[model samples]
Target: MILVTGATGQLGTAVLDNLLQHTPAQQVAALVRDEAKAATWQAQGVSIRVGHYGDPASLDRAMQGIEKVLLISGGGEDDALQQHYHVIDAAKKAGVRCLAYTSRALKDPSSLANHLMVRHFQTEEYLQASGLPHIIFRNILYMDTLPLFTGPTVLETGISLPGGQGRVAYALRSEMGEAIAKVLLAGTCDNRIYHFTGAEAYSFTDVAAALTELSGRQVAYTDVENEVLAGRMRERGVPEVAIERTIGFMTDIKHGQEDIVSSDLATALGRQPASLVEGVKLLYKL
Candidate 1:
């Protein structure tokens, strides 16, 4: 049985779509916070288990009868770290053979240039130490950060975060999903770590140009100080840590820390990861 946590989420849903193409529904289990949210998934024959990272009991309940489990991370919450560890513990208790987790690219200890990286590094470390068979997909920054460019708010307001034209090899979450499907099918491969990125690198200028071309609007990239960006986010009610971490991701672009393309996803799924322009056109109808 394959138990997929966060089954109702964007990534989770996409993973399920790919999984179903190659596997049977009886072998799949979906864990969601609201069982009601999975009504559509249930009707289609997925076993829906109601659960949440906040509650260990919920996770424990959902893991029952599960063989492989996908532990997708949740948005930043006070208990984010604990929640992740909880899932690992629960998976252990359920005696799942393989545990697949979604993680960030660049597992370097000093990669905290962003908040997500810090959490991802910690989560990856915890999973490895758990003595469980694990498969981790260290996905690169998502292209969906496109909203930071293509949307009316950023364009209309002329607000650009401080990437300083740094290049990022951003992959589409769909590609991540497709690669994850392959991993799930491949089962647990004894402490496997896959570093997945886009097939090419793109700069912030590339993003700005794409938005300008697609929307026929004037969008300029402005270099704001990281602290200023964090301040703005905090004023808008974002937690301090979240702002600090998110602003730090800008450094990945500025320093070209995220500029390399990799063939990992292609080798894994027998196809190339989507290109930046292709993704923009498909998503924005440009």
Candidate 2:
């Protein structure tokens, strides 16, 4: 059986949906923290296994009879490392034949200031040493985050961020999930490390232009200082931790950590990945 952890999350749901198209429901299982949230997958004939990353016993139960496992990276900047460690140990104990992990594609994942990147780097290293044959999908920055950066009032406020000329190969979360599903269904791949990203890279300026055209409004890209953006977020009552993380993302982009273009996604899906403008149209309801 192929078990996918975090099956209820946005990307996870997409992966499961795509996986169902290629494989029978009887061969698929979903590991979720909340059984209530897994109702949809359950309705679709997917066996739902209740488990938490923090609980080894639950993961053990979930991994029963599972040959291949896809470990979705858990959230949070601090406890995620430990959570991933727990999952890895449980997968190893379960005698899983293959393991796959969702990670970020960066030139230097370890050297990044982003807390999430650091945790991912640590988790990748842990997985490497676990002695299990593994595949690493180094996903690029999600196009979904573009909406978050532009905000809901972008048509009125324009695109305001600390991101300057840095370009990002922003693949849609759904498409990335599809690519991952393809990889899983293939049984195995020749390459261990897959850099899943959009076919084209776009700067924030390019994103702004696309938004303007899609929205039929004069949306401008305003590159502000990190401190200025932080102050604005603070005034809006955003938490300090969140503000710091968001700013760190902008800093990473500005430094070109996310400015990557890879055909891994297209190669996996056997089709052209959506461009930033097309992603914006769907996300922004344009």
Candidate 3:
């Protein structure tokens, strides 16, 4: 059976949704911290395995009888890297045939986002050294995060950030999940790395134009200094740590570290992935 961790989260749930379309639910198992939260999946005939990345014994039990596993990155918490190590060890101990990990797309090692991505890089290195056949999906920034980054008042406030004119090949999270599910269903132990990115790169200015078309408003983009944006965020009660992370991502974008475009996602889905306008409409409910 194939097992998926973090099954209740958006990406994991999407993977299961697509997986069940072409495979029997009995052949899939979901790993979650709370079985109560997975009642719906359990009702749908998927085996629910209670586990957590921080707890190796639970993970070992969860991996039992599972031929392939997808290890979704843990949500940012203290000791997150250690948590991933625990999961990798458990998967190895259980002799899983193949393990897939969702990681971020390539970025410059000296980029500002390095602090945020260090764990992913470390995990990739560790996974490679484990001697287990694996698939590494280097996913780009999700189009789903546009809403959070732009904020609710972006239409009114215009697109003001420190991202400059840098472009990002943003893929929809659901589509990424779909692609991942396809690979899992193929059951290959190819030990390959896939860069899951959109076919086209788009800048914040492109986002502004897309919003203008969808919302019928004259939305505009303004590239401000990092400090200026940080000041605005601070005034709005944004936490210091959050402000730092936001600035780091924007700085990386400004440096063109996130502008890489690739067709890996489309190849996996057997079609071109959604465009910026399409993603905007779906995300903004336009």
Query: For every model shown, what is its TM-score relative to the native structure?
Result: 0.88, 0.97, 0.97
Ranked by lDDT from best down, the candidates are 3, 2, 1
Poorly placed runs, candidate 2 (over 4 Å): 189-191
For candidate 3, the 10 contiguous residues with the lowest summed lDDT are 106-115
Best candidate per lDDT, number?
A: 3
Better of 1 and 2 by TM-score: 2
Candidate 3 at 203: error in angstroms? 0.6
List candidate 1 segments past 4 Å from native: 149-159, 212-220, 227-242
lDDT of 3: 0.91
**Ten-residue segment with the worst summed lDDT in candidate 1?**
148-157
- lDDT, residue 80, candidate 2: 79
lDDT of 3 by residue, 1-286 (tens): 9999999999999999999999999999999999999998899999999989998889999999999989999876879999999988999999998999999885675555638677888899999999989999999989998988888998898899889999899999999999999988887879999999999989999999999999999999999999998998999999998898888888888888778788889999999999999999999898
* Alpha carbon lDDT at 196, candidate 3: 91
lDDT of 2 by residue, 1-286 (tens): 8899988888899999999999989899999988999887788888899988988899999999999999999987467799999988998999998889999988777567676678887888999998988999999999998888888899998988998888899999999999999999998834399999999879899998998999889989989999999999999999999998999899889888997788889999899999888999999999
lDDT of 2 at 164: 87
lDDT string, candidate 1, 140-175, tens digits: 888977775334475576546777877878888887
Worst 10 residues of 2 by lDDT: 107-116
How accurate locally is residue 266 in candidate 1, as Cα lDDT from 0 to 100? Answer: 83
Candidate 1 — which pairs collide?
115-245, 166-253
